[model samples]
Target: MKKKLISMLMIAAMAVSVAACGKSTPSETPSETPSETPSETPAEAKDPSEMTIYFLTKILGNQYWAVVEQGAKDAAKELGIKNLVVTGLASEAEVEKQVQQLQDAVAAQADAIVLGPVDSTAMANPVNDAHASGIPIVIVDTMINTENYDAALMTNNVQAGKDAAKEMIRLLEEKGVKKEEVAEVAIQIGSSGSQTIIDRLKGFYEYWDANAPQTWTVLRDDVKVNDGDISKAVGFTQDFLTAYPNLKGVFGPNNGSTVGFVTGLKEANRTDLVMVGFDFSTEIETMIREGKFNVSTVVQKQYLMGYEGVKQAVELAQGKKPATKLIDTGVLIVDLKNIDNDDVQSIIKPGK
Candidate 1:
């Protein structure tokens, strides 16, 4: 990353620290990480107070995105961005709605746009159009297919998947799950169009294949796609429990899918299955505390995604592109042992 951009983002990055569990990486202090050469260094960019920055999210009213929205709002307030418009579809499935929002941002002559794409491939053209119109784009949480954006900040999801798999292995070993035992693990995801979830799934599989016991396998035949619907996630959880008597573990790569695992496991009154997944929620917290089932989650620095995304946008608005186009905000592994640790608490329930 560029020297100036590093100076701009380091203070906030240092102030927030996310703790890790089960070999997951904690949030790192900003450093001069090497990345692609700077794309553009305009002689002059818009002033923060004169800029109308738009933060477009994947969905609203969801805890994960809600926190992200709050982070953007807080950054806008902190930086004194004159017009910060935060909006998104009510559901992650609304790719067309997000596309329209991007078009509107261009039509409105936005100074910059921070986006969480609903569909990675579908959103690329709209993002490219906005970029073509000279709107600096900073992507958060999810990725678009094109390379037109000014900066991107998100978790290293593939590594996160490997971390989740490692945690799952630990839990299974703790339960005396024999290495040679024929057991099945299932995978659940929210949106097939989301490269974020896709990368997480990829990481998990690659790691599991290389490291897991030969007899243990991911139930690829019945891998469930919830399409961002929590209800469907819950139903899929029930199906996994009912159909696979030898199911020893399951992985939920997003909030809804993980919550579904928690709820469905409880409803079935089954505690024999070890569950590893992503995100933080009350349901997940309660289950961890109850110790009814084995559970651990990979919690992304979502707040940082929004906060840093805006900072990146503001940098671009000021004619200084981020030194690095891609920033891995890192993640924390939260499980029963360290749920109450200060660093973990700060992320799972910030400002509490």
Candidate 2:
């Protein structure tokens, strides 16, 4: 009986040891619970260095284009772009040259292009060709006749013209010149091919016809086509002043024309004539400060147009589309009264 009892106790101890070996130990068990949830992946960032933008202006060596170039450079630096090339013809009438530049940009494998066309219709084919080659183009300052561009950034030119007219009216009133007593007003245009110039003239005419007294006549015959030549503008203004001694106001729809008008007025000692024009320059600023005949100028946001044009082109190159195809950079009327204001100063001397 004692032997059987000892054997039974040994058998129970062996069973207990077997059970302990079959069970998992604390060290063998995992410390973390396996999660059933999935994690979200982040979007990849774009590489700006791979993008190259070409800026083709209507003309170079002008203050307006220079400001635009500076704005584009500022954007390129800020965006870390691989390259920003600015090129254009010497004259605004060089439509064929601009077309060649567009083709060259495509041949160079530019990622995108920003164009201020010399002629709205002449560049349609080249713009379409660029679009066909998968290189996006953004129109700036001026609009092309085609709808193939990725985007167009410009000012409300018609409104800008109306703004100039309104300012002219104000200045005439301040000078104690009654609308009926006013004999004539003359206008100067930079380029007849430029849609921007046409729209401005249209706006100016629309406003003046509706508001001015019936006796006041617009000197349509005296209208001069300067073709961006300041000397032509000056000569035209001198002739107009000599012909229309009763001229109440003069409107220059561009920088060259405005500058020419101011210079001509000074030379002729006819600073008493109210003048309103388009664009901004150091000379225009000085004339305004000196309280000359320059009543005000309708200044477009040219820098913004350039900066935004490049920005949109870069986005297009990166496979992104702009929220809208048309963007108005806006315009402001800068006169002696508001020239020093912060907003006016900002537009007048952009990126300062």
Off by over 4 Å in 1: 1-45
Candidate 2: Cα lDDT at 65: 79
182 in model 2: Cα distance from truth in Å?
3.8
lDDT value, residue 199 of candidate 2: 85
Tens digit of per-residue lDDT, candidate 1, span 171-194: 899878999999899888888889
- Cα RMSD for candidate 2? 10.8
User: Which residue pairs collide in model 1, if any?
Assistant: 1-323, 2-323
Best by lDDT: 1
Cα TM-score of candidate 2: 0.85
Q: How far is candidate 1 from the true structure (C-alpha RMSD, Å)?
A: 16.8
